[model samples]
Target chain A: MDFVQENSLAVFGPDGASNPIHVRDTIRKGLWTSHTSGLADGHVQGNVVILPEVLASDFLRFCQRNPKPCPVLAVSEPGQFTLPSLGKGIDIRSDVPLYRIWRHGEMSEEVADIASLWRSDLVTFVLGCSFSFESALIEAGIRLRHVEEGKNVAMFRTNVQTEPAGPFGGPMVVTMRPMPAADVIRAVQVTSRFPNVHGAPVHIGDPAFIGIADLAHPDYGDAVALMPGEIPVFWACGVTPQSAILNAQPAFCITHAPGCMLVTDLLNHQLASF
Target chain B: MDFVQENSLAVFGPDGASNPIHVRDTIRKGLWTSHTSGLADGHVQGNVVILPEVLASDFLRFCQRNPKPCPVLAVSEPGQFTLPSLGKGIDIRSDVPLYRIWRHGEMSEEVADIASLWRSDLVTFVLGCSFSFESALIEAGIRLRHVEEGKNVAMFRTNVQTEPAGPFGGPMVVTMRPMPAADVIRAVQVTSRFPNVHGAPVHIGDPAFIGIADLAHPDYGDAVALMPGEIPVFWACGVTPQSAILNAQPAFCITHAPGCMLVTDLLNHQLASF
Candidate 1:
C-alpha cells in the first residue's frame, strides 16, 4: 500500500467502470499502490517483468515458445519505459501498483516507484494475467471457489515441462480452481476466448495427472476449499516466469509484488479470440 | 422421417440420457430415423460425407486446411462401411437416421438407409457439427435466437475464402445469431472451446463486413429476429462441405440430409478445449 492517494472517484463514476488511463493516472501521481484486481473494470491487468537487455531476447523467445504460461501483453524496447501500444500514454517505470527488486536470485525490496532504478539497458515485459478471463467466467455464471472464499488461488509446480529457450526454461507453474464437474466444461469454454491471458486450462479433473499429489498442500498461494464432487482445474500460472527467473537467477530484474499488477488501457473484450 | 421404426424410448432412458450404444442399436434395427437431436444426450452428433476414393484425398486436404469450416471428427478407410473409431458397432450405411444419395453431381434420392447404395470404393468422413458447441452455449445460458424461435440458424456465403484443396475450394458459409452487446462476448467465449466443431466466430458486429449483404435474406435456413441494439454474430458453418460437394459435382456421393446427423458415443463435454 505505497500509492499516493485514493482516487477511485476520478476513475469510476456511477456507471462503475473508469477509463483505464484514470487508473494509471492515479498510479502515476503516486496516489495508489496496491493490488489492481478490480480497478478499471473491463480493462487488462498484467504481470510485470523487467530485465537487462542481455536477457530480454531469450525471455521473449521463451514467451513465444510457451505462450500459455507467458503470454506477452506488451513488451518495451531496451531501456524504454513507455509502452505506447498498450495505451495512449504508458510510463512503465512507475505505472504498476508495486514493484519487487530482484538481485541475483532473491527479492531485495518492495517499492512503489522504479524511476530511480530505471536503467538505459532495462527492458520491460507485460504478460497477460488471469483477471480478464475470470471476469468472463463470472459473467457466464460459473462460480470460482477462491473468488467466493476471498483467498488467493492455490498454485502448484507441475511436472509439465516448458519449451526451453536459453536460461529461461523451467517446469510450468499453474493456479488451481475448484468447481463442480459440470462447470468445468463451461469454464474451459469461457477462458479459451482470452488466449492473451492464460487462455485454457492446461489440466482438468485430477491433480495427480499434473503431478500434484495433494490438493490440500499447494506449493504457493492459499489452498482454497475443494468440495466433494468438485474437480480442481489448473491453468498455467503467471508465476511461471518468476519461477523461471528464480532458476535462471538473472543478474538484476524488477517485477510487480505478488498480488499487485499493472493495469492497462486495453479492454478485456479486446483480448477475446473472436 | 423416412428411415424405419420409431424407437426414441430404447435410446433415451427416463432421465433423458441413454447409452450411445442404445441409440445406435435403434438405428441399426431401422427403429429410429428422425433427426438425432436430443437423443443420446451428452453424446456427439456428426455431419457425414461419403465420396469415391478418387475424391477422398482432396476432401481430406480440404478438411485439414480449413478446420473451422470442416473439422474432421472421424474419417473412415476407403470402402469401409464400419466406422469403428466413432462407436463400438456402427454400420455407416444404416446407422444414420436418413441420408441423401447423389449420382453424377446431382441428388438422386433421400432414403431411409444407404445399405442399398453402399459402395466398396466409397470413403466416409464424420465431421464435427455445430450441435456440440450449440449445446455448450445453451447450457452456459447464452440465448440463441434460432433455438428459441425453433427455426434453423440463418446462414450466408461470405467473402472469406476457404483454403483451396484440389476441387474442394469454395466460399466459406457462416451461420448467424443475433444477441445484445453483453451476450455477444459470452457467445464468442463459449464457442471458442470447441475447435473440433466450428470453433469461435469468424466475424462479429456488422454482417456486411464479411460480405453478407442482407441479414434479412439468408442463403440457407430461416432468419430469426434481429432486435434493436443486438449485433449479428457469425460463426463458420458446417455447411461449407455441403456447399463444396454441390460445386465439386463428384460423380457419386452420399451425405446425411441437412439437419439429420450421426449420433456417436462421444460426449459433448469431451470437445471442450480444457
Candidate 2:
C-alpha cells in the first residue's frame, strides 16, 4: 500500500477526508500500514496498550500514579473491541496501522492487524501522545527540529524513577528538543495549556541533571543537532508507560508499534485545560 | 519615619489595613516614605513617568511600539493629578512614597511629595511593573531568590534595542532571575499570564548572548547570587522607558524613585490574560 498517497488523499487531496474516521477507515481496510504522524493533523493520536483483564487495574493505577508520562485518554471494557468514547467506530482489533505482539517482556512479531489474535479477556488502553502538544507548539510559531528533519524526536531513559504500582515500575522516559532561549519560553507556555498530552517540560538544559549524559546518543529515535545557542528541553514521554508495561512482563500483551498510533476523533485543541 | 513599622501595620500588623487605599492614604499623609514592595500584597503597582504634554503622545507611541518593556497601564489627562481610572482617589502628586525630580537628563532632587512641582502641562503615564507577575510566580510556589534574600532584582542593559519613536530609543533593560530548570519552566508559565506586566521572559540561559559581560555587576538594582545548578531568566524591564526619556533629555520630567511605585486598586490576578 502507498501510505503517503493514502495520507495525502485523506488529509489534503481532492478527497478532503481530513477527519479521523476516514484515517481509521483506511487503516482498518489495510490500505495504510505505516506511522500515523501528520495523517490527521489536528486530531489526537494515542499510544495503544492491550493487557488481560487480570492486570488491567494495576496498569490503570500505574497510569494514575504517573500521569505526565501516561495520561489516560480512553479505556476499553473487557472483551470490547470498539472504543465508543474516542470515536464512532474505533475497532481496537484492526484500526491501528501496526501492532506488536509481546510475550514475557520480549517483542515477538509485528503485524498489520490484530483481529485474529484478539481474545475475550483483553482490555485496551489509549494513552495521550506528544503529537497534540507538538501541533500546538508549531501553530504558535515555534519550529521543532525533528519535524523539520523528518525524523522522530529523541527519546532518552532517565534515572528518575516513577512511583511503583503493583508490578509496574521503571525509570521514566523523556523526549528532547533543542531550541533557542526565546522559543524555549514560548514553548513552555504553549505546551502547558495541553495538560492531557504530557504538558510542560520535565527537565531543560544540562541533560546530566536528568541522568542522561549524552545528547548525541539517545536511547530511542534519531537525534538532531543541537546548535551553540540552543539548549535541550525535555518532556515526559509516552514511552515511559510502555517501558513499565514491558518490565511487568505480562504473559500475553499487544501494543501499537513505535510511531504507529491510534488516531482518535478528539481534536488537539479539545484537550487544552484552559 | 519608621517605614518598616508602617509597612507591618499596613500589611500584617494589628491595624489590618492591607488594602491599596490604606497604603495610599498612609503615603499621602506623610507617615510612610520608602519602597512599596510587600505592602498591598495582591494589588497592582505601577512605574510612573510624568512628562510635558508636548512629548506625551510620542512617549505613548514609544510604549505601544515596545510594549514588552513599557506596558502602559493607565494615562492621566494633562494637569490632572487624580487618576479616577486607576482608583477612587489616586492623587498622583502625593500618593507615591518617593519621587525623583529630573531636569535636563539629571536627577535634581529626591522628594516625598510632588504637589509643589505639579504643572498644568504635565501628563502622568503609569506603566505596569514586574511586581504583579513576581507575586503570581511566588504564589504559584516558585521561589524568587531576591525576594527571599530581601534584595532588589538584578537588572542589566542588554544589546537588544527598542523600537524608536521620535527621540526615544536606547538599549533595552531586563531583570534577571536565577532558578532551577523546573522552576524556570513554571516561572515562564506563571509570568506569561500577565501580559500587562512584561508578559513572558525575553531571554534565558547565557547572559553573554544578551551582551551582559558580568553577572556579578548590574547597571541597576542589587545583584543576587546565582547558584551552580541555576540558569538566569531575563524579562523586559520598565527601566527601558526611563532610560530612553533620560537620553532624550526632556527639560522637565518626574518619575517614581526606584522600587517606589503607585499602588492601584486593581488586583494582580485581574491582569491574567487567561
Candidate 3:
C-alpha cells in the first residue's frame, strides 16, 4: 500500500490511516467518533484516564506499581488539557474520539467531546495501549489472530492480584493471543523492547495457571479461535485501570470509551525501550 | 569549570576529552594504555568480554537473566573483532587501551593488545558501563560524590543472587552513589532512561535491605565519603559478569582492565531508554 499519497499531502491508507494530524483534526472537529483501530497507522493510540486532583497522585503511584499493566506515556498538569508533549496541538477535551464519564465508580455516559465536563481539579493520564505492540508484532511478521479475525482481543480477569496503591487495587486484566511455540520467544523479546506499551508477556501457555477457567470465554472482548500448535500468550491489558476504578469506587473520573482512543503524534517505534 | 576549552579543538580542559575517533586511533597504535575515564566524553564506553563459542551462549543468557547488572551492548560473531555496530573502523583487539587475559579463571596478565591470543572460537560481548548514566546525571545537575572526590564508585557484593544461566551463576554486584534527599527521585528517573547502563536504582535509602553491611566498606573500587544530607543510592553494576565468571571458572576469558573500556561511536544519550 502507498503509505503516503503524493497529491493529498496526507498519508493515504485503508480508512485514512496515514496522517495522525488529519485523524486528530477530524476528531477535533467532531467529524469522526469511532474506534481508532486503523487510523493514524503507526502513531501511538492511548488509553485515557482522567481523575480528580486528590486521586491523581495515588493513581500515578498505582501506575508505577504496575508498570507492565499500566505503562504511562504522558501525564498532563491539573486542569490543563493541551498535551503538547504527546502531540502538536492536542486539546484532550476534543482529541479523543469518545469519552466515558464515571460517577462514584458507575459508568454514567459516553459522549463525543468532554469540554463541558472538564473540571479545574481534573488531571489526565495517557497510558500506552496494546495497539502499539500489535503494530510491532505485525512489522516483525508475527501474525496476530485477533487482528486477522477482526475481533477484539480476549481479555480475562485473573486471580493475579496487583500491588495495590491506596484504594486502587484489583485483579489484573489481561488480553490473550494464541501463537506457535517459536513465536512465543520472539514475542517476549520484541515486546520487552517496548516497555512503554506493556513490555513482555505476563503469561504463556496455560490459562488455568492464572485462574482463568476457560480460554473459549473471556471477561471482555470477543474470543478468537486458538489454532492448532498455538499456545495462548497473555499480556497485561490497559482496561486494568477501569477494573481497578470499579473496585476502588472513586467519586468521579473519565476514560476513553472502549476502543476509541486519543491518537498521539509519537510513532509506535518511538516508544521502544531501546 | 569551563567544560570545553576555548583554544583547544579537543573538548578543552582537564585532560581534554577528545573525539572518540581520535581516542581510538591513539589506542590502536599501542600508545595510551591507560584507564579511559574522561576520554571520548559524550560517547558510550563498553565493558569488554570475550569467551569461547561454547560458553558464549551461556554468558549471553546470563547477561539477559540479569539485565540491570549485565546489560550487553553488542555481541560479536566468533573471532570477529570489528564491531561495526558500536563504531566505525573499530578493531576490538586494538581499540581498547588495555586488555586483561584470564587463564583458568585467574588474571594472568594485563596487556596493551590481545591480537596474538585471539582465537577463532572466541566471541566478544560488549556490556554497558555506568559512564553513560553518570554523564546523564552530571547533565541533570546531580553531583556524583565519587567524581567530585576523584575516587571510583564504591562497589559491593550483595547477597541478592542473580538468575543463573548454565555455569554462569553468582551474587550480583552493585555500585553506590550518594546524593541529597531531593536528587534521589531525579536520579531514579534519569537512570531509568538509560537501562543499557543499569536502569533505575535497584535500591534507595537503606543499605541493609539489599544485604550490604557497612557503608564505609565495599567489595571493589575506592569508597567516597557520603555527605551529611546525601543518602546512598545503589544500582546493578556491570562488574557482575566478572563475578559470575569468577564463580563459573571458565578455562579462559578476556576482559578490559578495570576503568579501561572499549569506547564506541554511540553517543551516551543514544542509549537512553526513551
lDDT of each: 0.82, 0.85, 0.83
Task: Give the DockQ-based CAPRI class for model 2.
Answer: incorrect
Best by DockQ: 1
Question: Judged by TM-score, which candidate is best?
Answer: 3
RMSD of each predicted structure: 13.0, 21.4, 21.3
Candidate 2 segments exceeding 4 Å error: A1-274, B1-17
Query: Model 2: per-residue lDDT, tens digit, A1-274?
Result: 1122224353333645477888898888887777887777799999999999777756765775576898777776668898876888889899998899999989999898898899998878899999999999989999999999977899999999997766888999999999999999998888877757998899889999989988899998887899999989999999999999999999999999888899999999998755
Fnat per candidate: 0.17, 0.00, 0.00
- DockQ comparisons of all candidates to the true complex: 0.08, 0.01, 0.02
Which prediction has more favorable TM-score, 1 or 2? 1
lDDT of 2 at A222: 86
- Misplaced by over 4 Å in model 3 are A1-17, B1-274
Q: Candidate 3: global Cα-lDDT?
A: 0.83
Per-residue error (Å), model 1, residue A32: 51
TM-score of candidate 1 relative to the true fold: 0.52
Q: Which lDDT tens digits does candidate 3 get at residues A1-274?
A: 0111112313233456567887888778776667778777889999999998777756765775577798877766678898776899999999987788999989899888999999998888899999999999989989998888877889999999987766897999999999999998898878988887898899998899999999898999888898899989999999898789778888999988888889999999997765
Q: How close is candidate 2 to the true structure, as a TM-score?
A: 0.51
lDDT of 2 at A108: 97
Ranking by DockQ: 1, 3, 2
